[model samples]
Target: MTECDDTHGCDTISRRAALTGALAILASATARPALAQTYPTRVMQLIVPFAAGGGVDVVVRVVAEAAGDILKQRLVIENRGGAGTVLGSQAVAKAEPDGYTLLAAPTTMVINPALRSSLPFDWKTDLVPVAMIAKLPFVVTSGLKLPAKTMKELEALGKTRGTPITFGSGGANTVAHLAGEVFGLVSGAPVLHVAYRGEAPALTDSMSGNIDVMFSTLAGASAHVKAGTLRALGVTTAKRTSLLPDVPTVAEQGYAGYDLSAWVALVAPKNTPPAVVATLNAAVNGALAKPEIAARLIEIGAEPAPDTTAALASFMAKDAQTWAGVIKAAGIKGE
Candidate 1:
């Protein structure tokens, strides 16, 4: 009789625990969908960290248009350019993580935290990566009149020159700027780093011979390269870009193991509902995979690298480590 009483008590405890577990699961399942469905009840904003007409801006516009179509809402782009993207980044960092405020950020999103000492928000804790949109290839472009035709020849020129070659960057603490410094460190050359407000001004300076050389994105500088204004010496990736198929990669051009491919990605504030994040990620992945989107990206010298939130998180973490090493090696510190 005592054994029976004990057994009945055990059963009662097990049933109670089961009932509690089921209630918790039901609550979680119900809450997530409700939160996701209520998201973006108004117009959505896509924040671009750089000025308009830049490669990032172009990629953001493409995705924003497609996302608007998918979400049945007007997705607008807000340009908030300053402080090597800190101004814009902080804006997104502070926004409510409801899937309504999105950030169309670039590789600087990773670079900034490692290089800059003062930041308004912590990138790791504040931002949640949604997806990777495109991988941007960098080309070593020179004015048409410059004599260096290849990476080898360019390195030789820099070595022979009594002074450091002045290299223009899209901005201070940007991937382009860091690439120039990395090349300098690896090749044993003195590369004078020059910071520009944006890629357009830098490319313009490169085209008109105002700057000696620069690491310009294929998407932003290809038109000038094709127009005979700027000459492509070598691509800054491990493999040659399709837009400039004939141009050899920096590694192929005697700079072995050289690569610097920046990418554009979508991110939002943290704690956004998994379902809405999943939905946006799927839409972005699908749109990027479309032949039309892929072709347009290729035409503009951008490589589509679409992936889910998990993949993007891994990629972003790896990118952070890579840029951290580069920043330390180059001794690049922010103001």
Candidate 2:
């Protein structure tokens, strides 16, 4: 072969490499839509960042079961509870940005970042909201041994008692814990926070009178309230919940603007295809729209709060901002 100029040979090689890269990128872009169109070729994993049988797990199981049916694909739930949801959340955050892996994130998704100084992953950048499943309000419950029957009475008792009133939470930086912090902030009571592995244990301690009070999700605390083991003082919502319509709201109980509820939403790893997000959102909303699912959610003390992806993103942003202020003001820290 004839000898070639050094610049021409190098330029030709560079042009070939550039064209190859562009073609590869174009192929990836074209493949994503097709992949999204036929998503869930196999079973998908939905991670619940809480222990099994807890409020979030229960509600997510229900919704996922129904949604899986709608999608005609099996949605396996994987409970990866630890580190106040940081463990499981980070798993989802770092997972492949495909539709196969999803997260059933609760209020702690935002609260954890708010209470902690640094996280292994960035909540704002590592995860993307897909759909909002439900809003489960907290019920301020006290053991029968506590000498308080209402929110005002509880506040008064905490103030007048010689010893600091003890409040139990699922864990530090959890929604229940933050709710207790908010109570302390507004009520000016000397409250002691006792952290446990999970809500079930803390609720058990509350019922056994080891703890005086708990700001628990309605699903976890309603049974005890109905059985008269724990007395419900008020719900942590702006309005009364259908599950406990007789009980008043914390906002109405002299703590205006104390509307904190544990909400569950579906999220995927960042950069998941938009088409996949839309598909999953539609599936979730369809499941929530089912009459039986809605009724069951209500019975379990959750309200089906299906929303579009954009709306869920806005809601999550606002929620994170609100809790950031609360955490900073109350000097809350992660464990």
Candidate 3:
């Protein structure tokens, strides 16, 4: 036999080679659990792309606690807020695909691509959807100083004000900011967009009567509305939120099609095993089904909708199409 064949020959193999093969097999057998089955042998990190108090972070913490129950391990949340969630998203995208690293992303997941031409990571391709947790309807609220009580009245007042009404938003390219822009487009109202560091700063300015109006997730403005600091004119969603059931939707108020809501979802790095994704997704769905979880989400003006990866993907694509057109038409250049 040729030397090459002999080297790999079954019968010609040396006792030393046999011993080496046996040791390699033994090592693999011992390492299998650490590499696979022992997944999350420690705490898994879920990176929230926004500040701690935001809607996305709030919902994630709720889901994390519930999911943790099933996993029997702590699901730690890390807040990496900045650059409109890009920083956190990029960090998760580059993380190892061992399912230990996850991302708590917002509806901005789809909108960011349309806003910025060059992103650090490909959101659609790099992030694998684990669960679509819930959606927080955008509230069209104004400072208590604004006289308008309804969307139509707000439009008329905008005309009477003459100058484009300036509105405070969480940040540029955020869902609330984009929703305000869309509202302006549909209502034919002149609104000059103003970006803020976060909802708190924006609401503070709104409460101070410095800003005329603001678009925010219901959770951010719910307490302010209860305290009479801000006036809720209408929600920017198809259906009225349970938290603000008395308030009409923008569509019901005047605009025919003014539904815009921001969502929170869980995702892992691309290439994560499907089984792992399903396990996490199932946990989230189960958590949302809990009465306590649903009740808490309702209190925040959010609707619980634990959906599959396919459903999340389809919704994201639709959101991307809708907002991409709006962003492009409005010429929203990113920072």
Best by lDDT: 2
Who is ahead in lDDT, 1 or 2? 2
The TM-score between candidate 1 and the true structure equals 0.87
Kindly list the per-residue Cα lDDT of model 2 for residues 94-210, writing each as its tens digit. 999888999998888887776677899987899999999999888989888888998888888888977777998777788888898889889988889998766788888898899
**Per-residue CA lDDT of candidate 1, range 95-156, in tens?**
98888888987899888877766788987899888888999988889998777888777778
Clashing pairs in 1: none
Error of 2 at 269 (Å): 1.1
**What TM-score does each of the candidates earn?**
0.87, 0.86, 0.84
Runs in model 2 lying further than 4 Å from the true structure:
1-33, 331-335
Give me the candidate number with maximum TM-score.
1
Model 3 clash count equals 0
After TM-score superposition, what is the CA distance of residue 269 in candidate 1 from its true location, in Å?
Answer: 1.4
lDDT of each: 0.83, 0.87, 0.82
Q: By lDDT, is 2 or 3 better?
A: 2
Lowest summed lDDT window (length 10), candidate 1: 32-41
